[model samples]
Target: MEEETRLSRLKILKDIAELLNKGTDTRAVLSEVLKNLLNVTGLQTGWIFLVDQTGGYQLAAHENLPPALTLNQCAPMCSGECWCLDRYLDGRLDKATNIIECKRLEDAVDFHWGETYGLTHHATVPLKAAEENFGLLNIGSPNKTHFNKEELALLESVALQIGTAIKRINLTQREQDLALTAERNRLARDLHDSVNQLLFSLSLTARGGKERSEDPEVKETFSYIQDMAQEALNEMRALIWQLRPRGLENGLVSALKSYGEMLGLKMDIKVKGVINLPGSVEEAIWRIGQEALGNCKKHSSQEAVTMYFTAKEQEVIMDINDEGCGFFYDEEKELPSLGLRSMKDRTEALKGHFSLKSEPGKGTKIRISIPV
Candidate 1:
């Protein structure tokens, strides 16, 4: 009987761990915990309390408890208010071999949670892990001898397992945040190097050409110089368009059409999946299209190209196929163009994968898949 009880508790703990791994929302996890706790203890009314960073407890979950008892969003009682609360605060709950309870309100707190619900007995266990405190798991009943020693012990073990799961979630969130920050920083640097430098050069040329136009002999030369500078300025604008964040107003399809017009090439764009996306995703996809089309124009012997952009529930996919003669991926190994490298980098920077498929006789195809 003892071992069976232990195994049952272990099964509950395992479910909590599985919930943590599924990436469910915190509130959902709390709700699951509350439901499971009620099932395990056969309690009609209870509340799961948590200690905030300020050492005040808040209701995290409740089962059939009055809205007033569970919905009181204020900080919980201080550690000095109850022995159970004090034990949790002192980190003794995790180290304990048995469940502990504060049978008297004066021992846990001089509060009226039980009186309001006509309940007198309850159990409290610490919810904690190595790095931080999660809060407390407390279950209550109106019956005088409702909680047994074995039950308390089971609850305590469950609390430790909950703490570990919570800790894992917190760690995962921190890592994701760090990765996002690093990606933003990398994009900032790339924008500075690629687009900003071209604009600066265009600015200097425009100013110098305007000054030279003031002299008659230099006027003719300035016109020629001005024309060349204007061309550079136009190319710079195109580069900026490629690098800047895109929107649904100019999504993959529209952007491709615009690029076709700019290049004076007859092309068609087909779009599938969700057309609207965040700017970072749009920017990365646009850069990939730019590089692929640019390569088609520079290398392909064919005149027309077709671009397809597809979005699935979890990924964004792109296919750029040109009719021009294609070069082998292995042949390009020794000499990689800057444009292709830039496209690959942009896709990868978004946690996406990029690949190119081509043969000597077949047209080149660029493929990209980014997570949604």
Candidate 2:
């Protein structure tokens, strides 16, 4: 029986490693790992917490959680106040720890008339690769209060695998981000050097014609041409800025305001809560906002737009609305609009939500919510 159990554990580990090696998205990968842990190991509950840059733990994945330990309650348990995280922070939780009774669970049991709870103790292993500590992998059971040495060893090995996979995913994402930034810079330079210069020359030529013309009608025509050329020049510059946004380094709000000014659109902007966000989340919002503004410029009869931005601890929300001429939104016809589709795709790729509301006579409103 001992040898059979060991072989079974090894097979479970192999299956989990295979799933992790598939290069799936982080959420999907972690969810699959948690599910496999529960299914293969017969653990009553399992969860993985990831340490964010702010030194806070976020529940990245979970499975088979009981009603008493709800998701919302997980925040406090992951805080530095908890025993596992406290040990992790102090460099004491490097190895799997067995029979660590949970104070929170004890309190819950005591509060509920001193009855025995379904869970009493859990094993925690530090999810680490090299010198980097990712977070913790925790497993618990109702009947099994303590883990044997062999069980602890297997859990530690699984934790190591998870940590290594997380590191690989992060490195891959960084590489892709660098590639994207480089490509955008190249496109921005080309547009500015070629299209931008040509538009400027057209504007100058129109102005010169307007100055030299004596006929009222001829001068008016030249003035109209000059205005159009100048407008096109402004739009081109805005497009280049969108491609490579230097102002984004300053902040998202400033960059967006600058873009709106370039488009000659009057914007009513309101921001609420703290605005600090992960770089990728901020970039997604910026790109989606740019698309929405571009659509407003192209379709709206009104020149004014309203933008509201909110940043909270767990998520960021943006709403862009315009009182412009709207179109009939149909899933069959209007869904194919490149701008709308692009915005939706970008939002969904980040595991965010995108919603659009518009009618033929009514104005357009776009709302995006992203969890960070």
Candidate 3:
């Protein structure tokens, strides 16, 4: 009988390993694993939290949660602090172990939030790969309060698999991002060396022809061509800058100020914290800033803009403001016309916040907040 139990556990581990290795989408992988884990192990309930460096967490996956815990569409699971998260933030939860009765479940029981279904306690484990700690895995059963050595071992092993899978996914994503960046650099160089140069030459040639022409109509035509070519050249340059940001290494604020000036705007820049940021954060900021300033130049009709930058341990914020001819639109309407959608997409890619407030004659302000 003992030999049969060991073989079954081994099979479960093998099956889980296969599941973890099968997918690129983090949430999808975790959801499937959590469901199967509970079914095979006889545990009735489980969940996983994917936490960021800022100590913010997302409930990545859950299984067989009782109605009380699942009340209001899992609002109980989504909000507020609990013992596991507190220990995780404080660095005390280092391994698989039984924790005190779950505070969340306790609250639900005391407040009559829902049926507890006999659940009172849970086992918690830190999900980590080497020195990089990701988050926590929690599992429990009806009327189960204490976890035995065998239970702890299973939790530990499963947590190890989950953490390693997360690390591998992150590395794979990094490699793909690096490859995409390299390709962008090559494309930017090619455009700058060929089409960009041609546009510059065309603009200059038109200007020269305008000067040398005797006919007013011919000069006017030359002037129109010159203007079109110069506008196209400026647009191309902006695209190149997006493809390969040149000045972000100095710092985000400095690069932004330089970019704003390049757009022919007087830059009033104010920064509140020591400027330090990762490359990914900086890239997202630069791209979003570029779009905001471009919108100002094209629609705001204002020559001066203000940029406010603030950095903190958990979050960084940027505000772009222009006291120009702002316009109003229906909030429900799609806003792709002014590059707002593109900017929003870039900010959200970093799990950031994007908000815009504008009214006719009231100016425009775009605020972006991103976690570090």
Candidate 4:
């Protein structure tokens, strides 16, 4: 029991720390806390009540509360309401712990709120950091007298950790967004002013030189330069497209098609797909494909590769199969090269599924799927 309790605290602290590092918004932070709370307590129902702008707590995560409480149909806490919070706010209940007895609960606050709502026994703990009361954490049970003093004390500790962690997550999310935005802008401008302009000029030069060059060698040289310039421009444009914080609104089809066409010269690649996923999802897959194809050209001894993209209502899938000599998948036999790691990171960063299948003498196949 002691070990379980300690691990729970550590896990909550670690997750909250991660959340703070991620820089998610307030609601998202709270949702994560609620999820952890559910895991720690193993309660049948629960809810998080956050202090709204109205100076009273509003229901944020009411797992099994009635539609009224769960959806927050009722606004700020009111005096004499039967809700458990009424007792807490009235100072008739203990603030040091969160668990409350169902039978002992008293308030004109609408006892029916619990009786009809299917919550018999539950605990209401104040989510406080230092001395400031930020919110209420409610854990419910269908059976009477389910929560005890000891459980409430543990919950109090959990609440303290949650409050601080949520604040950190919000701060981190803001900082991360600001940093990403700044980096994206810097990269976008660099490509536009330098690489983009050069490619445009070269394309025009190659076309213009065609009429002026009477020498066959000179014409071929200009043609090759033009081709190289066009390819470079396409890639630069793709990078620019990715640099857009808004992401690829054109969806996976457009992203893959553009990427494949841009890469056709260096590698024999075929891409086919039709999708309209969120910009983030599309960008993730596009980047993964880019990294995978780059690997094919750099390391894979294959003549050609084909990428099949498909999306249904719930999932978006991609298959990159190459006829090149494949490597061993076992860690003991082979370590993940930098290129493979990059591919995995791209998928994981988007919270998607990434898998690789390969063996000596056989070809390699990369399969990835993300929720749409």
Q: Pick the candidate with the highest TM-score.
A: 3
Q: Write the per-residue lDDT of candidate 4 for residues 1-372, one digit (tens) a residue.
A: 989777876776677656545545666666766676667667666767776322455556555554433223443222224445665566564554434444323321254333334444567777766655667777776554555666767677777776776666645766886788679989898988998998999999997897699999999999898999988887787677567533345555455555555555233344445556765676677778777776666566764777777767667888888777887797454338876777777787665788888887788899988876
lDDT of the candidates, in the order given: 0.67, 0.83, 0.90, 0.66
Q: Least lDDT summed over 10 consecutive residues: which range in candidate 3?
A: 329-338
- Per-prediction count of colliding residue pairs? 6, 0, 0, 8
Q: Which regions of candidate 2 are displaced past 4 Å?
A: 71-80, 110-117, 246-372
Q: Report the Cα lDDT for candidate 3.
A: 0.90
Error of 3 at 170 (Å): 0.9
For residues 283-347, what per-residue lDDT tens digits would candidate 2 score against the true structure?
A: 88898888888888878888899999989888789999988788778655557488888999999
TM-score, prediction 2: 0.67
Better of 2 and 4 by lDDT: 2
TM-score of each prediction:
0.48, 0.67, 0.92, 0.48
lDDT of model 2 at position 151: 83
Off by over 4 Å in 3: 329-338, 348-351
Q: To one decimal, what is the Cα RMSD in angstroms of model 3 from the true structure? A: 2.2
Rank all candidate structures by their TM-score, best first, as comma-separated numbers: 3, 2, 1, 4
lDDT of 3 at 89: 93
Model 4 clash pairs are 20-169, 23-172, 23-173, 80-109, 81-109, 82-109, 82-110, 98-125
Compose the digit string of candidate 1's lDDT tens values, residues 22-101.
Answer: 75455567668768777866776655666755456656666775433432442333223666666777766564332334
